[model samples]
Target: MRVSANLGFLYADQPVTGRIASAARDGFDAVEFHWPYDVPPEQLRAALTAGGIQGVSINTRRGNLDAGDFGLAAVPGREDEARAGIAEAVDYAARAGLSAVHVMAGRAEGEAAGRIFVENLRFACEQAERHGITMLIEPLNLRDVPGYFLTGTDHARRIVAAVGHPTLRIMYDVYHMQIMQGDHVRTLQGLGDLVGHIQIASVPDRTEPDRGEVDIRWLLDQIAYSGLVGAEYHPTRAPGDWLRDFRSSS
Candidate 1:
């Protein structure tokens, strides 16, 4: 299982561009971003080329944080903003040579929100397909993100099935899953090809995988995915130190 550093959390002390170089220097061949809109695509591409690392995936812009907007995609009456964010993310991912775009389903509920989410996902899938990029939707845990639209593996699967688009798939974050539900091994194994990307961090504390209550290494051994597993966790020590320890122990 190859691991990619999640620049959003792994190297929080450095600038995004510097995080790419740091990830490369630490032997990571791939990295993922949360919101890199502040960084120009050309600059990001240049940094990735210089570091000889691949930029794997990025999330769509979360709308108006000050206004309590976690995402725009599923919010009623915000279709324009949602689609705009989707277009921007897909375009940016294509320009930066990223393989996928994660569409965030904002804090919403009821049948109306569900319908809006499906429609937005279809739009995102269509745009992503034009650039040969995959579109992903993640289920955020309610504890950390209360009122989040998507919060379970089954819900994500149903949404993907409803869209019926090949480019659209689920971004399974183990940390969130562990919080919202247990039985990670069975859940992931059952999801199979529906899962487009995977992310990991410790449960309850949101720290290094090795420090979590879950036996991450053992859990990883039971899975059969060949794609890059994102190391998306906050580190208490130097990121490299925990990485080395985790790898050596593995």
Candidate 2:
């Protein structure tokens, strides 16, 4: 029932890292960064240490988007390139004392692309073990990330099972799941422990928890009852205000 705030977009509007700590203090138990490599890892580590918070996870391979690389995992025939990116991500997360590395799966596709992604992902997972970091492969929705590969929960579950590694798991985002597929609860139930972490934003809008049609309080209850640690990972108009409504036992 611990709630980890998503600082990816939150930090964009509130650049000062301490402000994020204050938000977490308001109610959240921990915080997450989108891509810590984009910022100085030491600076973020200092902020987290000062604020008494935990940086749950962040993206390990978001390509220089403006540079046209969306990510590293799915580029056809680019295993080495993807591995290099993952190495950096692991280094940053390890230095920052993060618990997980959210692997950014690329939007690239096709049979050859799938092969590359699986190979590169397996390598990344092996590398992450040295850092003592669990790798969570995130699946972005096509609507938000058109052409991005790795968009289905069932398929992702299959991949994790096939890989058969405890450290490699899925970063199942509820918002993206609603868009790419339905039955969020069922999907998680199916995945079982293959799911390492979760991110949730309102469906259709990706905003505050209460803003979308999802009854996240109810969802949280389900997750808690199931004995999984579900973070409130999302953006909001007023992060604290949005957090105020969640009852741990609800």
Candidate 3:
């Protein structure tokens, strides 16, 4: 399976361009970014081309993150802002030659939030499809982001079914699922068809996957055929050693 580096955590000390190159140097086939809006599209494109790696995914802007706004898509009466965010992300992804966009569901919850989420997602999917990109929705564990609207893979699956959009799919994050529900192998087996992308990190500590209670290497091997796995975790003190272990195990 292909491995992608998540620049959001992996290279905290480097510039975005440097991080892209670092990911390629570490043997990652592709890279993902969380809110890479700060970087110009032209700059990102050049970096990816220079690094000889694909830009696989990027996240829709999280509205006012410091003001406690994780996302705007699921929030009531913010449909306009959410759609704008989707449009911006879609345009950016297309310009950067990315394959998917992660639409954050924000902190709102309830029937109103769910309804708005579906509506926003359908709109987002339509926009993404025009650019040959997929729209991804990930479930964040409550312990990590309490009050998050989407907090379970099953719930995300139901939303995808309800929306019934081919380009709309779930981003199954092993780190979050391991904390929310322990039976990952079975869970992934059941939801394999609905998953659009996968991300991994060590459980409890959210560090490199080399050492963890969940045997992350085993998990990656099990789902290797399903899709690309993204290394979305904080770096250990010895980032190079951690990556070496991942390369050796893979």
Name the top lDDT candidate.
1
Off by over 4 Å in 3: none
Query: Which pairs in model 3 have colliding backbones?
Result: none
- Candidate 2 lDDT over 65-90, as tens digits, reads 78667787878766777888888888
Deviation from native of the Cα of residue 66 in model 3, angstroms: 3.1
Candidate 2 Cα outliers beyond 4 Å, as residue runs? 224-236
| lDDT tens digits by residue: candidate 3, 208-231 | 886677898887667534567898
For model 1, residues 57-127, the per-residue Cα lDDT tens digits are: 99998899998888989999999999999999999999988999999999999999999999999999999
Estimate the overall C-alpha local distance difference test score of candidate 1: 0.91
| Whole-model lDDT, model 2 | 0.74
The RMSD of every model to the true structure, in order and in angstroms, is 0.9, 2.3, 1.3
Query: lDDT for every model?
Result: 0.91, 0.74, 0.88
